[model samples]
Target: MNETIRALLSKLGGLPMPVADLADDADLYAAGLSSFASVQLMLGIEEAFDIEFPDNLLNRKSFASVAAIEKTVAIIVDGRKVA
Candidate 1:
């Protein structure tokens, strides 16, 4: 999952540095993730994970960092399993 997230970031993050070089807790916005890029990243995430983010999760906090994104995806994926 982490690798996948990193791959998505590498492809869509538009960061000045490589996503693989950033720490899990690194602030993506600070690393140059613009709002447009975040939206693109979100789309990539949805496609890659096969999960649509809930409306409640559509916010800056949910995409704050790699760890945050991982947590959000885990929640959605786990919820799907229970349903």
Candidate 2:
């Protein structure tokens, strides 16, 4: 999942540096993630993981970093399993 998120970010993040160069907790926004790119990254994540991000999770913090995205995606995917 981390690899997938990093791959998606590499393709959609529009960051000045390579996704591989970033730490899991690195600040993506500070690395140059634009608003539009973040939206693109979110859509890419949904498509890749086959999970929909609930409205409550549709905020900056959810996509703040690689770890944040992993946690958010895990929450939605795991919740669907119990449902």
Candidate 3:
């Protein structure tokens, strides 16, 4: 899941630096993730993971870093499994 999120971030993050150069807990916004790019990243993640991000997860903190995105996706995916 971390690899998938990193791959998606690499493709959609539009960051100035390589996604691989970032730490899992690095601040993506500080690494040059614009608001628009974050939206694109979110959409790509949704498609890649086949999960819709609930409205509650649509916030800066949810996409703040690779780790944050991983956690958010896990919650949604795990909830789906239980349902």
Tell me, by TM-score, which candidate is best: 2
Q: Which candidate model has the greater TM-score, 1 or 3?
A: 3
Model 1, 2-83: lDDT tens digits are: 9999999998888889787889999899899999999999999999999999999999998999999999999999999999
Poorest 10 consecutive residues by lDDT, candidate 1? 12-21
lDDT of 1 at 38: 92
List candidate 1 stretches off by more than 4 Å: none
Tens digits of per-residue lDDT for model 3 on 1-83?
Answer: 99999998988888889999999999999999999999999999999999999999999999999999999999999999999
Pitting candidate 1 against candidate 3, the one with the higher lDDT is 3
Q: What is the per-residue lDDT of model 2 for residues 1-83, given as tens digits with 9 covering 90 to 100? A: 99999999999999989999999999999999988999999999999999988999999999999999999999999999999
For every model shown, what is its TM-score relative to the native structure? 0.95, 0.98, 0.96
Question: What C-alpha lDDT values do all the predictions have?
Answer: 0.93, 0.95, 0.95
What's model 3's TM-score? 0.96
Q: Which stretches of candidate 3 lie over 4 Å from their true place?
A: none
TM-score of 2: 0.98
